[model samples]
Target: MKVMVIVRATKSSEAGEMPSEQLLTEMGNFNEELSKAGIFLAAEGLHPSSNGARIRFSGKDRTVTDGPFTETKELIAGFWLWKVSSMQEAIDWVTRCPNPMTEDSDIEIRQVFEFDDFGEALTPELREQEERVQTEVAERNNNAQGIPASKDEDEIRSLAKAWSGSLESKDVDAMLTGYSEDILLYDVKPPYRLKGLEAYRANWEACLPYFPAKMKSEHRDFTVTVDGDVAFAHGLHHVVPIDEESPVGQTWLRITIGYQRTEGEWRVMHEHVSVPFDPMTEKVSYITDEVIAETI
Candidate 1:
């Protein structure tokens, strides 16, 4: 859960009073603790209300009011966005925070609403739009901070497609970029599983030459799901030899990929590719009209 801890303004805060050096040091130490615990997302103090203004709306009419108005308790002076297990955890952290003002102050903790909270009201289309908006906001923030923007689901999907395309083109470097240094791959071939990027790349090097010089590959029924820094995608891939004389072609290899965001880049952390086999004969089954119908 995420919560915003708001520091309410006091008379001194509204008057533009700044915290003492000792208080600032104490607050900094507390912030360090929060960061170490991975609970802190963002925190900032606002300028005094004297430098702000508010607009009031009544139907179509609007009225503007200057700040440093009488209600000090109602004004916010600072806030911290935190991720915690529960409201109780938020409260416990808040209790340990240093006083943000020279005088006694009050801090309010409010839970942030998540997409799931909207339930059925958020249609698939709306959900996509929301994700786009979120990506835009994150990119803007990254630009302001001079950090590279992280890849979203669409970008990751493109990367996955490029990886598949590399197999046909035999572009080892491009294919290598799709995976992380610690990637784990479960391929259809022998050895059961391959660990690390070196092993995975070696496997590709040994197999690419066996494929046709002119090859065609397509990803079908692809689906990608992203949640925060982790994501996973699944699809069926069909590979065919472009040459009419070549008999080496396969259809519908089940593929699943897992990705993780590392330093603003999405890299494949895990991959699993397999073909169904008969239990009795231990023979791999290729896709066919009858097989598709049965599966459907």
Candidate 2:
């Protein structure tokens, strides 16, 4: 079970007062303990409502009110996410926590709503989208030394195939259309990193002559892992050369791609390719493992 612990400080508590240095140190130590226990998923402390605002709607009219309002009893100052085996376990942990505010303060612990708890009212698509967003957010937070999020594998795989197909077809115009105006690309080959539509097109044009020449290259073992709006894949290029003696020899190559969702559609953001070496001649080879892995 996952639960949210909201810490609310009364206006009187925060009035002309700040968190003491010793209290700050204690809070840091408490957070470290939570991390070590592996039960802490996320946490944050917010600024006082005195610096916030509220928006309200009455019929057709909307109103915005500045903070420092009189309702101190209803304001929240911070929150923490905890994952435990049961509600009682969470309660036990909370019972052990030191008071977050001076004098007497109240902390509210509420269980997070799980998808299954919604009964049959939640559509699969909506759930999937929610999961994707959560996963992406979690990945980013984890990368930034924060709590983790979830990821979806199927959607990412489908998106990868679509992207690769666009490339193999040389649908340059359509493919480039997917990218943002300020897009950035990273690849293992020439033009190391490219930015903008013009530069990307130039790089593609320079490399067009190296395609399969007969059968188009296919993206194989295309497994995509998506977190929120970002996704990535481990894929392979399967192609037979038109000329036998070409320097870029071999019928297969390894590729990894990273993508970001733009304007509600997935687009390639970064790509990496590696041509392994042949032990016999110490030369680069393209007979990648993805084909073999797929077969297995």
Candidate 3:
């Protein structure tokens, strides 16, 4: 069962008096115990009611009241969400907690409702809807234990890192193996988009002549995301000519690539690359700080 541990506001809490260091330390220790026991879900301390508001509902009408609500005992200062076997277990855990405030405070434990508790009142359709909503929320929080991916994120990341090897070697065949026959690409150069594998190869072949015979390819601030059969990555690519005097090098050429898992293999489906330019002069700009890694 899930229960909320409500920390009832006291006179001191309502007055916005902070808890002493000793009390804070004790509460921290108690929370650590809960975490180690695998009973902790979430916890938070709220600001004083003076920074809060209340809404009253009657039929279709509503009204709002600003707080420091006078009913200090009825107000909550903070709360924790916990999952335990039963309400009694929640009570036992609460009893073991240290004093949370400078003055006496009442902690209330209220059982959170489970779908089963609604009994037949919750129809199969409503239950399905609720389950779907919960699943979505859990997935967003990375708590959806039942939802598993294809376990190819690492493989995709490996592909990204290996591309530099092909670049440094000027191995067009090796680089082509990473892309699909239907690959689409948008390069920093003209011909806005390249469609199909032939165009992809042609673009590479055209650019290879200008590339340094001996160069170092580096990718920085790279991020890869995989979802089922689809994946994407973006990063700054830096290519340096081995000859210090050579000018055929780039510092922050932005690169974005898309991947698709087909059958049992992953392939590049799309790609986009560009460099930042100054709007006024329409000239390329260099980033001095952490700018190259995070954004376009």
Candidate 4:
């Protein structure tokens, strides 16, 4: 489960009083512990309400209100995003947290709703729009902060190159660096579906004998899309024999990779590799089809 841990504002927090060095150190250590436990996703503290504003809606009309809100206890001073097993688990973790404020404070834990929580109500179109908005929001935030929007795209492109390089060298351990432990892959070969890191490594080992001793990899027409911590890329790939007449010629296989940014690193969680298929021929069609490989 995912949860939002909200730290309620206190009189001192609303006054813009910064935490003492000792308190800050304690909180930092607590956060480090949370991160090491794989529970921390993000944490941030806000400036006092005096630096913020509120917008009120009345039908089509709007009203702007200045802050330093009177309800100090109701306003939030900081928050943390965490992925945990259950509400009780979140509570247990929270109990170990250092005091967020020098004075008395309150922290509220609320479960975040997953997309599946909507059941059948969230249609495909709505999910698409949601994903687009998420991407735009991340881009805009980075732009507003003077950060390059293409940073993640550059990383993903570099990762693609690194992946092909690993494949060319036939190094399963190197290739597994960017993959998740519970990775899932749908391949072009028989027993096409592979799950877990071990199965993926075995798949590579099984096919290595068929590959030429010296090989080169080519990846083309690659495109990447990122939405916050989730990203995906698709491209056409070919493994070429360096001089030996290989059994498998330079066949172009369509490849798609699903990436998740966890603990500040992007890892491939799902992958799909296949050749084009023709319904009329009822066999694997040999072509570099430009259609999208998969959807979010």
Candidate 1 runs further than 4 Å off: 150-296
Pairs that collide in candidate 4 are none
TM-score (C-alpha) between model 4 and the true structure: 0.48
lDDT of 4 by residue, 1-296 (tens): 68999999999999999999999999997887576444677999999999999999999999999986898888999999987645765887788898898888899999998888998899999988987897798889888999767768767766766766677778888888888999999988878788999999999988888888887565656778999999998867777676688756446778899999999988999999998778998987665323323321
Residue 132 in candidate 2, Cα distance off native in Å = 1.3
- Per-residue CA lDDT of model 2 for 209-273, tens digit only, reads 77655433345455567677887777566543444555443545677877788777767776667
Predict model 3's lDDT versus the native. 0.80
> By TM-score, is 1 or 4 better?
1
What is the TM-score of candidate 1? 0.51
lDDT for model 4:
0.82
Top-scoring candidate (TM-score): 1
CA deviation > 4 Å runs, candidate 4 = 135-296
Instruction: List model 3 lDDT by residue over 5-94, tens digit each.
Output: 999998888888898888899999788767644468899998899999999999998999998799888999999998665565578779
Model 1 lDDT per residue over 1-296, tens place: 78999999998888887888999999998897676444677999999888888999999999999876788889899999987656766887798898888888999999999889999999989999999999899889989999767458667866865666676678887889868999999998888999998998899899887878876555656777889999998877766676455655655778899999999889999999988888999798887546766986
Ranking 1 against 3 by TM-score, winner: 1
lDDT: worst 10-residue window of model 2: 146-155
Total colliding residue pairs, candidate 2:
4
